[model samples]
Target chain A: MRIERADFPTSVTLDVRAGQPLALVGPNGAGKTTVLHAIAGHLPIMIGSIQLGDRELVELAPEARRIGVVFQDFLLFPHLTVADNVAYGLRMCGSGRKPARAATLPWLERFDLSDLAGRYPHELSGGQAQRVALARALAAEPEALLLDEPMAALDVEIRDEVRAQLADHLRDFAGPTVIVTHSAADVAALAADVVVLERGAVTQRGTWESLRAAPATPYVARLVERREE
Target chain B: MTPARRSGPAVIIWVIAALALALLVLPLLGILLSAPWPHLPALLVAPETLQALGLSLLTGVISTFCCLVLGIPLAVVLARSVGWAVVPRRLLRAAVTVPLVLPPVVGGLALLLLLGRNGILGKYLAQLGITLPFTTGAVVIAQTFVAMPFLVFAVEGALRGADRRVELAAASLGATPFQVFRTITVPLVAPGIAAGAVLCFARALGEFGATITFAGSYPGVTRTLPIASYLASQTDLNQSIALALVLLVVSVAVLLGLRDRWLPGVRG
Candidate 1:
């Protein structure tokens, strides 16, 4: 997919084969999230086009794009149960009660959240909430997935563990997924290709190995240094 | 509990707070003590009193429903302007709140000029064989007119405080705008909506000046509880006191029910 947002003064162009996860890593205010938002049709892109598999996404409404997003803080509906949160998108698309509830079963099992089906978002720990959020996103069966700061809100001790778990899931997903984060560790663990953004511009794009071997920008060089530390 | 040390300024602050509390409560205390206990039951059972009470309850409920239907959307519109430039939003807010600060009698007069039989749109209504002045429907309109601002402001405050990021997340999850509004927006601010509805209901129940001016006091029609109590004051002092006591008790109950919101740190 190629997405550009001139309104944000940021333009991003990328191509991804299905089942390959790309990471958009940058410093804060580098417009990593802005790029993801433009692709998801949340923020309007004034100049340039966003196309996914011959379908123009820039002009489509968010609901019409068939894209799933897991936010930085999970953004689970606090009033809904774990199962109901997962079931929400299906229900919105006109699924019956039985079908929606049934659809959440596999995702709940996949995320190891079956036992927490009846619990509210507030009752779940941060790690559990993250899993539930991912499950909620996956239940919608979108053409593409976008995750913003996937491991940012997790407890420091469990961050790597969750990252490993998420990496396992991303490997199995057969969609073009983009994860926006500032963490080099997240880029190393969860993604195959890294797109380094700096100051609302594309600084470098390559495999982590290539980017580290010949760091193109000061930001990429710093990221490699931070990753080593 | 041991007393903490208090300085002169702290002691003065405490005394002033207590005095302010008394200023609010003393009038209610007077109402409670001065109610005619001996004849309260009889006064309450009187046919006119029962009719007025039933009418008040009915109109109050219907008006509250109207406020919910109209006010919630307006509140959402107003709240959505939070990210925009301030001046136009403030102007819209002031326009909606005009009825709140405007005298109830004046509001009733304005409504009469717009909807009364001989008035502007009312002339058209008259041609269609309809007359709104001195009607039961006019009572509901007046109460809604005077009370809708309360609901709008309350829900707007709630909407303003809600997390917009969650809404963006929902939209990305393939929820249509209406679906997001129903499932996400409404539930997130459910407490505010409930509070606004309660405030709307109470205000509608107590509405007097606008209802009297627009609908006029016709027995079993526009003469609601407040109007009945007012009429009672001319003939029987005991009945009026009993009705006033009822109103006071209801107001106290509403205040207590909303204590958590107004009186912070008070756990039920």
Candidate 2:
């Protein structure tokens, strides 16, 4: 998959291979969310094209693109039960309720959320909501996955445990995964390759250790050194 | 209740709150106190009174339904027009809310000019063999014209307050825009919509000036409860007071009945 948008303060291109997790690390207002939103087709890309496999993502609607997104706050439908939330994507694709429920069972089991299937989102803890969000996104059978600040909303005490769980899920996912975050620890643990973005531009692109060793810019070097600390 | 030990700010705030509460509730209290209780039941059971009450309910419900059907889309467009040009957005908002600020009689006059027989659109409507003025339908139109802005404002506020990220997430999961609106937007703002509908109904039920101006007060036809009360005041003050008490009681009951359902935690 490739994405390019040439507008100032948001101009950047991303090349991602299938089954690889790429983390775009940047400071606040570094256009990280803008990049994720652009790839998710929420924001229009004016100057460049986004091609996923043989399909051009720029031509498709956000719904038709089949791109699963886990929002920063997890945005679980408060009105829906855990099971229904998981089943929503299937229902949207025209599956009947019975079949949608049937297909959603595996996702509940995979997230260890089988017991909470009937509970509303408000009833869940942060960690539980995060898992439910991931399950909801993956249940849609998307061509790619985009996670925005996956662990940012989690409690600090549970961050490591949930991050490990999310890493495992991303490892199991066969499609390309892109995560935008300010946390270098998130990149180290979850991402295979890191793209250092600053001021809406890619300053460095390589594995975490290579960027840590080479230190392309002061911001990238500071990020790497902070993670080591 | 002691005045001796109160702090300065607390006393000032309490005074302001008490004055505001008095401003709101004193008139209603006066009405309740002034009503002649002994003659109330006989007055309400009168044929003209019953007819007007029934007409009020019917027109109020119809107009509230119309407001819901028409106003929800208007509210959605208004809320989503945040991205639109500032001039047009403000103009639309102002236009929708014009009835809220415009005198009810003037609103009725405008509707008459637009839809009265021999009026611009009314001429065409009359040619089709449909005359609207002084009809029960005209009463409903007048009520809707004045009352819909309350609903549009309420639902628009709710829609703006709703977390739009949920809609985006639904779209990303492959739900169509209409699907997202139905399943997500509507449900998220259901409480606001319900409250708005109730408000619209209450406003429509109480509509007097517009109904009288546009539809006229004909017994068992365009005459609603307010009109009946006005007509009764000319002949029998006690009966008019009774009718006023009925309207007050019904409006209070409607609010009290649905208060907790739509506005949880609000103390009556």
Choose the strongest candidate by TM-score. Answer: 1
lDDT of each: 0.87, 0.91
Interface RMSD of each: 4.5, 3.6
Tens-digit lDDT string for candidate 1 (B1-268) = 3356547668999999999999999987887788888888998888988898889889988999999999988999998877778899889888899988999999899999999988999999999999988989999999999999999999899888888688887887788898899888887777788788889989998998899999999998899889888988999888888887777677567756763463211111
List DockQ for all candidates.
Answer: 0.60, 0.58
What digit string (tens of lDDT, one per residue) describes model 2 on residues B204-249?
Answer: 9999988898999889899999999998899999988888888998
State which docking tier applies to candidate 1: medium
- Return the top candidate by lDDT: 2
**Cα lDDT for residue A184, candidate 1:** 88
Q: After superposition, how far is residue B3 of candidate 2 from its true place, in Å?
A: 13
Error of 2 at B182 (Å): 1.3
Candidate 1: where is the Cα deviation over 4 Å?
A6-8, B1-6, B84-87, B259-268
Worst 10 residues of 2 chain A by lDDT: A1-10
TM-score of chain A of each: 0.97, 0.98
Q: Which 10 consecutive residues of model 1 chain B have the lowest summed lDDT?
A: B259-268
